[model samples]
Target: MTGKLDAAFGFHETALRLRSERQGVLASNIANADTPNYKARDFDFARALQQATGSADPAAAAATPAPALARTAPAHIATGAAGTLVAGNAPLLYRTGTQGGVDGNSVDMEVERNAFTDNAVRYEASVTLINTQIKNMLTAIQG
Candidate 1:
């Protein structure tokens, strides 16, 4: 039915939006690698998708609190501080490197490269899934 197609389209739309936003965040972190005091940021894709899709709890929307603002400076950087301060359901935050750099920048080249690659693969998968869904719908209508 057309309604099924519509539902599939909605899911694809949401997936695309999420993927685009994630790509933007990753690209921003890569771009700011050289900037002093710039902290890397990322989001938890699974948790965010669950929240967005209303899968975890229908009432979560009403109970969820606003994302905390990123602190420009603090008296001291403590362990686990970043865990609590994500900007949104994103679950993304600035990561502190195990090995500190002279400039206080913590962007690890290898880690970022891996993350970028993984994200790209996931994005491609999402696109492929959407395409298949569309193809299925078209076949159904044609038949």
Candidate 2:
């Protein structure tokens, strides 16, 4: 039962976490907008979410000779491939500057603000879905 719940909620939980992480990066970019030589950092949410959900690398999986063994730990999800990128550790890509700045700060206020707002909406959606799932589970167990 616990494992089932974990599997069901895993994607949402990971999404919430990754969204928060991305928000932090965006916020950092906003906060340092005036700082000289500050480079804006961000990641691809789609790739991060796919990785978090233990999405198989189709190419790698197809070429594999044998299936991966199940992991023993509850938190040890995924044997996707030799180099599966984790959500928590997704590589950060520097945001390209739209206009030349004398201070060399790549933190664009408009871009960071837009990204932050988008992330916040997605984060809220993920939280709402998680809550709904929990409520449904509780109703099932109680009745």
Candidate 3:
């Protein structure tokens, strides 16, 4: 039954999880906009989703390689580009070409705001897709 549901929902489930994880990274970037030397970080959604869903496409797999980060100590937590615990295998890339602040902070409010809004929209879409699939499955079961 678990496998049946997994097959039914397909990649949207993984996409929803990745989107939620990315929201945390984006939110952390916005929250630390003023923190000195704080570099804004984000992952390629398409690439992450492909990897998470275990795509066999070589081109997509090579497009974005997930770099493994090692924890120096057991108590040390894995931190994202913004020093937040963004748990996932998605590669966190630093935002480039943005004007760095005099204090060395790399977060641009405009960019962060735009990314956050975009991610939120995508997340909602994923949730809606999953809900639709569930409703269709329930209807089939009843009928």
Rank list by lDDT: 3, 2, 1
Q: After superposition, how far is residue 52 of candidate 2 from its true place, in Å?
A: 2.3
- Model 3 TM-score on a 0 to 1 scale: 0.78
Which 10 successive residues of model 2 have the least lDDT summed?
A: 81-90
lDDT of each structure?
0.71, 0.77, 0.78
The reply for model 3, stretches above 4 Å from the true place, is: 56-88
TM-score per candidate: 0.73, 0.76, 0.78
Candidate 3 per-residue lDDT, tens place, 82-122, comes to: 24223345567888835869999999999999999999998
Ranking by TM-score: 3, 2, 1
* Tens digits of per-residue lDDT for model 2, 1-143: 78987889877888888998888889989999999999888887886676567684758535633333566788986666323333643456788888857999988788889889988998988888888988998899899
What is the model-wide C-alpha lDDT for candidate 3?
A: 0.78
TM-score, predicted candidate 1 vs. hidden true structure = 0.73
Q: What TM-score should be assigned to candidate 2?
A: 0.76
Residue 54 local lDDT, model 2: 64
